[model samples]
Target: MKTLGIDIGSSSIKVAVFDAANGSCLASTQMPTDEMIINSPQKGWAEQDPNTWWSYFVDAAKQLSALVNMEDIKAIGITYQMHGLVAVDGNGSVVRPSIIWCDSRAVSFGNRALEKIGVEKCLQHHLNSPGNFTASKIAWVKENEPELFSRIRKIMLPGDYIAYKLSGDITTTAQGLSEGILWDFKEERVSEFILNHYGLNKEILARQVPCFGHQLELNSEAAIILGMKEGTPITYRSGDQPNNAFSLNVLTPGEIAATAGTSGVVYGVSSSIAYDPQSRVNTFMHVNHTTKDPHLGVMLCINGTGILNSWLRRNATKGLSYIQMNELASQVPAGSQGLTILPFGNGAERVLGNRDLGAHMQNINFNIHSTAHMLRAAQEGIAFSMQYGVEIMKTVGVIPTVIRAGIANLFQSDLFTQTVADITGATIELYNTNGAIGAARGAALGAGYYSKSSEAFSTLKVEKVVEPSRNPLLQEAYGNWCHCLNQQLK
Candidate 1:
């Protein structure tokens, strides 16, 4: 049997087929042959049409089906960009462009929530301040676009929207609610406190389903459009970061996962319920969480990572490819010869308490510094930012002695891999797994094809391991980077 996993990412749609027996990827493909568009109608805002995601998903699924027997596909799973708001009317028509995760327009709304709901109360119940999360995004809509809010019969994250399209069902998992800041961690259910504060009807929320269970089934209309069989159960769905952790076999406490895509994330699983008081590092329900076991994920997100790399490539590098830039960066020494980069340019970073300190390059020397030095500093800056947040996780008792990452995106860069390890004093493991494959395995387990989590990820393997280099020089360099970052934040 095979399970299909679809990831509706901020940049593209990726689909994978995995062997349910061994948890190995059978085939995978992404469509458009280019990145999807993220439309920003105004500064600090990010939006995308839900229909565009569906369109690419259909094309990618049909194309993946042609590479194998469609009959062999047993189930479908979806992992999507988290904290996005997708509103649909009673007739299921999209009410407007989805307010995506990184949009910072709701920062004020979230601040109001902290004041009105009381910061202590919010931290106690939601495990973080509501800070520009999905709940605040909806509140923004209700305040600014009252008419649109009136038409909204349902609100969903990007993944939930895709699942609804596939199954003709409108529902969300507890994990999804956690990402949206809608779950009350203390109560282990949706937060009536927040709902009452926002004046949002509990009925507007999707029916809550178990994070990993038989949650949805493919509809005939979706089956015909995607050329798959009807009634194929969508056994699993999760936010991309949580799914990335699940994909990395980091299910148990003390196991940690990191990903550097358009954004950077460090997700650690813990059995204990904890919250970050400042709401900088958000916590959410893990995919395997249950009322009985109570697993939660402590997530640290940096909005600017690869996007800063892309910005440099577009504006600074002029025409050099990323590979060329990497080669140039490799020529520079560890510290980039006193050059430093602050990569918070993408938007207001939650790690910095939702502050929008645009990207900056410090200590540039016109005569001494070269592009190679700037490139190296950029990569190191990203790593330093990650280390900064890891410090917060350490404070909250999710100290990771080692970090696991997939061999994709920035992890594919040797400089980034080593910098992260050396700076944080942790070993870094790179595996040959990605989110779609993880979602597939999760689907198999959720659909009861596998009886245990270990059995589900038995075939998972590591491709490489990076140990922290015992170099005082590198540590000192990171200290300097941290000092510079602290100065900038001040």
Candidate 2:
């Protein structure tokens, strides 16, 4: 009567149970009384204990059981942060702390591997640079900690680790492999070129499994711990982004999904096999991706939006709250009176050719521009950056007609949302859903409760809709912003 989905994230473990008949969330909650700590033993490194993730999962299962009938759960699914490296020995015990998605320790390894593989060859086959992804992290281990590397019987992504814990099986989907930069899209298999380059063998990698099939059945040990029936099949698994897309029904080509958090991402799904020469957006396998029917999630990330806004709040906003800031800025007419603030102050942006054009506050007139103008310009700049990235996505055939996003993060800002919608000329639909809900829907579809993928989104609630008003001011601001960006690049 219900399908369960667990989102294993860096921040927390979110679990949701979905009603099979109506596709509505029956129960959902995130565990861990506090945010899980990301240990940085050294700067630019992020790691977490895999055992801690399992503990949170156990706690979440216990919490969910108290809220709903655990016996009604017919199938299971998992979604998690992408590009993490979890290694285990033959005994299936974790050998090291997980090198999470945000870890930069493997950057040099990834860059060196790319040079060895040749840029064009890597883009052509790997569909990505080996940069800071799972394989590169593994390569770092192999070279930097050879003794530790030798003991790693197998390596898997974050979600795969959770699945392994539940089912006592080590397997992954092609989608998972692709996110880890371990898949050869051209060859449609594990990248032997990378393995050979990194001096690793296929034996250490998890076996490939179907993304929407019976990946594995729950083992007695995990079942008893979680108060669930043993042998329950886990039918779906994916990285958080792809699963978030699926949750919003952005499955087929031309459908789009966007998330604006510390980093802003616009994921557009398309059937065409394409790659950006500048690597503005990374391509990953969508949940429904197949060799026969290619579903590519062309992801465009603008590394600044929320972080820039937060910085402004802490330092520049003086005493105004975010709501007050939004209200005040809403009064300022478009273009912020010719003042432009480039939101790229966060760090190097991929969309801008991986350049760190250190957040320029340009064309400033201290007399003319007030705090309101700065706020408006900052929001517009962030929106323009998204518009800029989406333009790059278009170069690879990912033009968004409708952008879907959760009713969270910067999308919560009417000024920000309207700016993005108007500039891109796309209808923005805000959904009251998250990654766990999407994985739950995926679970039902995989369990054959829904005949088609679209049916799974029947109860997906749309909180609001922002249709483009053809706002010429936003267009003018974007043009002005782009000109300034071009000058900065030169």
Candidate 3:
């Protein structure tokens, strides 16, 4: 038995085929050698065409088919970039380019909704302000583009749109709605209050589906395009952060998962209904959540993380490979000898109260500091920014004794991983897994191919463990970084 997992990311589309019997990945590949472009027509706006994602999905499926028999794939799972708004017409054609997660254009609408709905009511029922979420984005379209809004038949998240293309079903998960600020935690359903406030009809939203269930099956048309057998069930769907936690087996409370991709996120699982009073760290339903066994993922996200490193690689380092950059960064001492970086340039960061402080590099010395110092400073700054969010997470009872992460992206850097461990004082467990692999495992569990949920991760293994080491110099450096951040905030 086999399962196919597709992870729809902002950068690219990744597909992995997993053996259901052993949880081993048979083949994996990503489409587009370069990162997919996020079209920015105006400042603070980020959009991508849903058809572009479909095209990449088809391309990736063709590549994977070359490696294995597509007919052998029994089930499919989808994990996607969260909080995006994709509107479709009655014929299932996209109405507009998707307004993605990092876009800050909807901030004002979210703030207005927060005030209109009352902060306490929103925090108690929704667990977050409608800040830059899908609902707010839809509201933006309603107010700004009335014609487009009137033509919308269904609104879907990024994953739901992809699934619709595959199965001809417009559906979304409770977790997906929650990430969009459309799910009412108090009622455990869609938020009519938010919808009314935004002047949206409930009919615009996609039909609700369980995160793990027999959600939909591949149709003949999709099968032909994907080069897969018809009737392959897509059993699981989730936003990337919750799915990231699921990928690392961090389903229970006190277990935490961290990832540093284009953005940095620390997701901690908790059973109790909790919310940060300031609405800094957002909470949503975990992939394994249920009415009886409620699991909430408290997530702290830093908008700028790996992108800062990528910027340095492209402009500063002159196209150095990530490995070469890491090697150079490792050579520098901790603290980068007084250089500091604040990686908040990408967009409005949720951790900083939706503040767009912009990226900053403080205290540069031309005579003493080299490109190696700049590289190390960028990594340390990102780790410190995450530490800042983790501190806020601690306030909401998400104190992490250890953090689990896949051995990819920024975690691939020893210096970056060690810095995070030392600064946060949490043991870092590196896993041989990614979002695509996790979705595949989730598919097996959802499709009943595995007898138990634990059976789905039978092959998940810890590749390495990095314990926090006592280093006063690094501690002082972190303190310095914090000081710089505090000054900028003030």
Candidate 4:
């Protein structure tokens, strides 16, 4: 049997076909050859049309159908960019453009909620301050776009919205809700306290479902649209980070997963409930979490990571390939020769307490610094930013001695991977699998093709392992980078 996996990402929609019996990806493709447009009507605001996602999804499915037998695809699973707010009317039409993960427009509203709801109460129940999450985004709509809010019959994360499009069922999972700050960790359900505080009707929320299991079936209309058989069950759904961890088989306590794509993330699974006091690093239900076995994932996200590198490539390097950029960066020694880069330009960073400090490059000397030096500094800065968040994660008991990541994005860079390993003091394992493949294997597990999660990933193999080197210069460079970062924060 084959399984279909769809990853609804911020930049593009990805689809993959996996051989369920062998856990090998048969085919994969992405829609819109170029990155999808993220509309920003105003600074600090990001929006995307849900209809655009559906259109691209259909395009992606059509491409996938040419490479695989759609009829043989047994199950569908979805993983999406987390913390996005999608609202739909009773007829399932989008009420407004989705407020995506990187949008910082709702920061003030979230801060107000944090103050009004009381810090202790929020920390205990929600495990995070209402800081620029989906809940806050919804509240923004209600306060600013009151008419649209009144018509909203359902609120969903991006993955939930895609699943609804596929199955015509409005449902979400605990893991999805937690990413939105809607799930109450203490109560193990949607938080009525948060709903009441935001004046949001609980009815607006989608029906709750388990992360795994047959949640919905592909409807005939969607089947016809995608040239797939009707009634194929959508067996699994999760936010991208947790699904990335699941894809790597980092399911147990202390096992960690890292990803550096449009954004950077460090996700660690834990058996106990833990919260960061500052609410910098957030915790949510892992894909395999249950009331009895409660597994939580402590996550640290840096909004600016590969996007910074992409920015440099576009504005500075004049269209160099990422491989070229990596090769150029590798030429520079540690610290980028006293050049420092602070990659906080993308949006409000949670690790910086939802502050939009903007990207900064300091200590540049016209005579001494070269383009290669700038490229290396950018990579080192991104690594240091990750290490900064990892420190907060350690405070919450999710320490990582070894980190697993896919051989994609920044992990493809030897310099980038080495910097992360050396700075964070952890062994980095690179895998051949990506998010779509993970979602496919998760579909197999949820559909009962595999009786256990282990069976689903039994074929998973590590491609390479990177260990930290005892480079004395790395520590000194990190210290200088931290000093610059602290100065900016102050």
Candidate 5:
């Protein structure tokens, strides 16, 4: 028998079936064939219909059923984009469009909340600022859309909403609550102080469930619609980043998981109870976190990463493919011949004190520069940006002794991976796995298919390894990039 893993992401819905015994993906499919649109009702606001995610999931499930026998699926797992706010009414109907992770509409509310709640208290109790997280998004709705807020019977993260649809139960995990800055790290429960501060009632939040194990079972209606077996347990659920780390087997302290997708993220696991005072890097409970054996995942996010590369491809590379751009980048020497680019144009960066310095290209040296210089500088800038956050992450004890990433997205580029390794001074390992695959492995552990969590990773393989280089020019390039970034901030 195989276990099913469903990944709900902003771009698409992916479904996979895995053989738990050997941890092999039996079949997998991604739905809609096209990128889903993020509705921006206003500038800096991103929203998506909750029901649309369900619809796409149903479509993906139908496709998955075509590849494997529905009866062979023993359990279900779910992972989704983090920190999204989904509110449902008493009848479990969506009250409004979900305020997604990229939405910046709640910045002011989150800032005010941080000031009023005090940084020390928030950091001590929640291990993060309530900064544009799900809780702040809910607060924004409560103030601006009172009618809709009144109808909200329960609010949950994106993964919790999917679990609700699958099992007819509304529940969340402490890890989920921590992502929303609603978890009390000290008390080991939801933070009632935050709820009271936001004038929100604790009753509106979903009840807590363990991140793994038999949290719920497939409801008959959902089972019939998706051709899944009724009473099949929903065993595992997590946000995408933590799930990615688990997928990579980066469960111990000093191990880090990095991803360069539409945005960039570095999630490092540490056993120590820690928090970044400036909120430069957010901290959330890891998938395996427990009171007896605590694991905190410190996350560093760059709003711009692959998007900057995509922008370079569209505007600067003269219609070159990503592979071609990487080739051009490789031709250029380190430091891009004194040219530096800061890849922070996507939006306000939390790491940069929520400042939108925009994308900066410095020391262009127009007389000698070519497309190669620009491409190489952009990639190097992203790597330097990650190193910048890594410096701050070190403050909270999330040392990136070894960084693991999937052999996809930016890691697919040799130039980018090498630059990241050289800049961060850490060994980098790339694996041929992803969030959905990790969920499948997690389901195996949660459903007792595997005797221990480590068994699920027995088949996980390393595709490549990158080591830090002792290149003076590479070090000089990062120094130049930092100087330019400091100038922009000033």
Candidate 6:
């Protein structure tokens, strides 16, 4: 038997099927994807067709089924990009392109919300300001496209949309609501305060469902289209960061999860309720959160990382592959000699209190700085950006001693991995896993295949562990990096 997990990312849709008995991946594949079109009809806006995700899911699943017995798939779970807004009409048809997680179009609405709700009240109840999250995106729709907004019957995140398509059910979890700034931590329900403040209808929210329960059963329509058995349970769903943490077994307090995908994230599990005053870092309900045993995720996002690296490869490096760029970066000495790069160019950064400080490169020398030095500077800038957020995580009492990440994207770079470890003084462990695999493992537990979390992840092992190289040169390089970051931030 197996469980299937689908992760809808900004860049690609990844699907994985995990063996229930051994908790190992049976098959996994991502489909013929162009980089998702982040349509910027206006500056600082990013939107994507919700239907495109549906198409990618079907395509990826078809490819994955060729390698495994599709009939053996017993459960389905979904992990997706967070803070996206997907509105469906009465007929369950999408009304507009999804305003995705990184979109900054809702900044004005969010700022109004902060002013009206009062910063202290929003922080106390929502654990965040209503900054470019799904709720504010909805407000933007209501004000700008009133006709489309009026026809909305349900509002869901990207993952919720996928689950609805598979199971013919419309529902969301508390964890989902929290990520959208729609959940009230104090009330333990959707925040009526935010709804009232934003003048939104509460009924637009899909019914609340358990995060790790029988969320839905496969509908005949979806089952036939996907070549799956009818009535298979869809057991789990979460935002990618929470699911990433679950995949790493970072469910308990003090466990830390870091990933450098299209964007970067440092998510740490916390037992104590905490909020950042500036709402720079966000707090969301973890997949295992409960009234009795609450676990909140303190998430610090950099909105840069691999995206910046990819940009450098495409625009700056004249079409060098990521591996080629890594090779070039490795050839440069530590600290890039005297060059520094700041990777804050991707819209408004949440870690910088939603500031839109575009990326910059400094201290360029015509004779000394080669493309190798620039490449190294870019990678170091990415690591330094993450380390900056790591400091914020420390302020909230989440001192990460060891960081866990999958061996993909930027973590695949030895220079990036070692730089992160040396700069932050945290051991880095790279896993041969990603978000969807974790969701599949989670589905196995939800389906009663595993009695304990430990059992569910018994086959999960670190592929490599990098301790902070005790090399004094690394320390000196890191000090130079911190100096560069401080100079830029000031």
lDDT of model 5 at residue 211? 86
Off by over 4 Å in 1: none
Off by over 4 Å in 2: 32-43, 305-348, 355-378, 470-473, 476-490
lDDT by residue (tens digit), candidate 1, 423-483: 8889999999888887888888888998888888788888899999876766776788778
lDDT of each: 0.89, 0.86, 0.92, 0.92, 0.88, 0.88
Instruction: Point out where model 5 deviates above 4 Å.
Output: 314-320, 365-367
State candidate 4's TM-score. 0.98
What digit string (tens of lDDT, one per residue) describes model 6 on residues 195-277? 98888889999998888878889999989888999999988899999999999999899999999988999999999888788
List RMSD in Å for every model shown: 1.3, 3.1, 0.9, 1.0, 1.9, 1.6
The residue pairs in collision within model 2 are 247-438
| Best of the two (2, 5) by TM-score | 5
Candidate 4 residue lDDT tens string, 326-400:
999999999888999999988899999999999999999999999999999999999999999999999889888
lDDT at residue 301 of model 2 (Cα atoms): 76
lDDT of 3 at 49: 98
**If both were scored by lDDT, which would come out higher, candidate 1 or candidate 3?**
3
Model 5: lDDT equals: 0.88
TM-score of each: 0.98, 0.88, 0.99, 0.98, 0.95, 0.97
Residue-level lDDT of model 5, residues 30-148, one tens digit each, is 77675677788887778889888999989988888888897789988899989999999999999999998878888889889999989888888988888888899999999999999
What digit string (tens of lDDT, one per residue) describes model 2 on residues 1-490?
6999999987789899988787678888887764577787975677999999999988888899999988778999899988889999889989899998767677778778888889999999977777778998999999988898889999999999999999999999899889988899989899999999999998999998899978899999998998889999999999988887888888879899998765688998989878886576889899888899899999887767776777788788886777888898898998898999888764456677656677889899978998889999998998898888888888999888999998766788898899989999999999988888888878888878888876777777789999988877778888999999999999
Clashing residue pairs in candidate 4 (N, C-alpha, C atoms within 3 angstroms): none
- In TM-score terms, candidate 1 sits at 0.98
**Candidate number that wins on lDDT, 2 or 6:** 6
Count the clashes in each prediction.
1, 1, 0, 0, 0, 0
How many times do residue backbones clash in model 4? 0
Better model by lDDT: candidate 2 vs candidate 3? 3
